[model samples]
Target: MPFFRWARIWVLSLSGLVLTGSIAAAAVPQDMQDFNHYTFAVMWHPGVCATWSNAGPACKDLSPAAKINQEWTMHGLWASRPRSLLAAGMNGPTWWHYGCYWYNPEHALPKGSCANPPLNLPEALHQRLYAHMPMAQICLDRHEYYKHVVCFGETPEQFFPKELDLLDKLNASAFTAFIRDHRGQWVARNAIMKAFADSFQVKNADALELRCENPSHHIHELERQGNILTQAWITIHKDKVDAFPAPESLEKGRKGNCAEKIHILN
Candidate 1:
């Protein structure tokens, strides 16, 4: 089985994009928003697997015993820019791309990163986490842990559970249900954003950034024969993260890459 790799994504620069007209999000109070935000990224398994032709055995396991597509799985709880990395001139996009491997390619393994030191999560967290996060098959857990979580100001115990808790909230929300109910169907991007805002009872849906494997870009997407919804990245204020699913807790996220209408793979 080939290692599951994340094709470089969300590589577009966010600068100079004017928040024009009615879609503009209210200016976040300067004291409230800046770099103190974290992106809680979740993957739709079927779309994820279908995104790449060389996806690993985890996606090939066709067993009913491990139906990983039953729900969204962790991508990572990515910090925008921790102070140390920022001072070192690691801007948001650069930090988002390279993650821990920005410093050294050898810091990451081409195969499974399972050999990286294990996370020190508590037993309870480990068990709850074991329930999903299917990419653990490719040691993606270790990849994400080392790359995104290490400097995130929370221990593995603190980070994973908090992310899991938020995932629960999203799964329970109308947002998740909207996508889940529409699996195998094409849905308008605007509608998806609207459902997300309605689910959280928020004024702005821009807090949710949508990502997809586009047929326009990848041949694997052509194989899927459509645009496939893959991930949703939500911006949560660091201080208000514990209060997520609340309107004020989520800040606006920049636009992401995806077609105007994308399919949610069944």
Candidate 2:
């Protein structure tokens, strides 16, 4: 790690800094070593609420000071399988061994480290998680910690804040700004990819992928037309935080379900 980044983490530990709306912390656990890459999944809150609200509790109203608009909300941070293994179909057991204890293909529940509390975090830490992840009935933070973060081997203290920080980074990026500003408009898939490339200074469209949902289907109980942006998945290397691979280099499942053009719901 760079000196400044290392120093920031050290200072945070010594000070036990409080979590806030603007920034969150991330940790690299001693035992849970780095892997092939990481996936930072971000959700469009408006799309989620439109389709999933009735499936769970309504999202909490945001405080006036919260930086998140109804624009983007966090989904989860995931450790991705290496491209080599992915090519060999290392999705089920192999993927779980990396830290996300997924249930076997035939099962509905996962079996692994996340079965219990991953850390002994204080109440304040929990509050910070709740603040950043406000969608209801899901116990979003707890579920994420168990399913994803637990396998990461970081304590709750080290994990939650870091994930929140990643979310903040996304929310502050030009990519998110472009999507939010273009709401209520139909955007071409290429335009979306180009915007991400421009915003992040990534020249390759293969660096990122967008997931869209067809809300017109009654099976999902949403009323939106055509496809709607739901999640943005970005790939990063395990050791380096910002290293991105071309989209073709990503796992096969990264591509989302969308047509040539999709509507950006407000």
Residue runs of model 1 more than 4 Å from their true location after superposition: 1-35, 60-67, 101-112, 120-123, 214-226
Q: Model 2, 1-266: lDDT tens per residue?
A: 23223323422220122211112224433323435666777777656654553434434543323344445677777776534335545565656543333321222243322333333458897666665666523555655665565434455677767767766776777878898788767788889888877776666556576887756344322224437777777776566553333333333235666667766666
* Reference-based lDDT, residue 67, model 2: 46
The Cα local distance difference test for each model comes to: 0.66, 0.56
Error of 1 at 232 (Å): 0.4
- Scanning candidate 1 in windows of ten residues, the lowest lDDT window is 1-10
Model 2: pairs clashing at backbone N, Cα or C within 3 Å: 25-161, 25-162, 26-162, 206-246, 206-247
**lDDT per residue (tens digit) for residues 77-121 in model 1:** 776765544555556777766664443323332244655555645
Residue 245, model 1, lDDT: 82
Off by over 4 Å in 2: 1-34, 53-55, 60-69, 82-89, 92-99, 102-121, 216-226, 242-253
